[model samples]
Target: MLYYTIWTLFYSVNFHTSMVIMFSHINHKPFLGAIHDSLSLLFL
Candidate 1:
């Protein structure tokens, strides 16, 4: 049970870090096309 709890915590932390990196990358996009595509999906 202790191992399972530790593993879950590790997995969640890793996932959150990766998501932050991905959003930062998307935010840094140099082209409007990419931003437009994402925004379209978001508003739809």
Candidate 2:
């Protein structure tokens, strides 16, 4: 249980920071597009 909790927090923060960085750049268009498409699919 402790391991799971630690991993969840780790991935959450890592993904959050990576996402923020991805959004902050103009050159990472494809990554941003993929993220947008994935979000749209989830909503649909």
Candidate 3:
């Protein structure tokens, strides 16, 4: 159930949008924060 929920949320954003948001976020943060942000994004 949880996995499906996550997948649905991810799909709703789609791939390219996710990548664009991810890179934009990575650009503003420090290295550690970027790593954290990236991991968080991936899980979502």
Candidate 4:
């Protein structure tokens, strides 16, 4: 039971971290674009 609990906790943490990393990576390009647009507007 203890082993199962530990495994579940580990799995959940790993899953959450991977999801966050992937989400950030996926959004990274769009985020950069937004920043670029804002900078361009500022310069304009």
lDDT by candidate, in order shown: 0.68, 0.71, 0.71, 0.67
Query: Considering only N, C-alpha and C atoms within 3 Å, which residue pairs clash in candidate 1?
Result: none
Return the candidate ranking by TM-score, descending: 1, 4, 2, 3
Specify the poorest-scoring 10-residue window by lDDT in model 1. Answer: 30-39
Candidate 2 per-residue lDDT over residues 1-44, each given as its tens digit: 99999999999888865765666464556776756754676589
Give stretches of model 3 more than 4 Å off.
Answer: 1-26
TM-score of each: 0.63, 0.56, 0.37, 0.62
lDDT of 4 by residue, 1-44 (tens): 99999999999888755655565567775555655654566589
The alpha-carbon lDDT assigned to residue 40 of candidate 2 equals 71
Per-residue CA lDDT of model 3 for 6-33, tens digit only, reads 9998896687466656776759755566
Output the worst ten-in-a-row residue range by lDDT, candidate 4. 29-38
Query: Which candidate do you rate higher for lDDT, 1 or 2?
Result: 2
| Model 2, residue 9: C-alpha shift (Å) | 0.3
Itemize residue pairs with steric clashes in candidate 4.
none
What is the lDDT ranking, best to worst? 3, 2, 1, 4
Backbone clashes in candidate 3 total 0
lDDT of 3 at 15: 70
Model 2 scores a C-alpha lDDT of: 0.71
Candidate 1 residue lDDT tens string, 1-44: 99999999999888755655566587875455555655576689
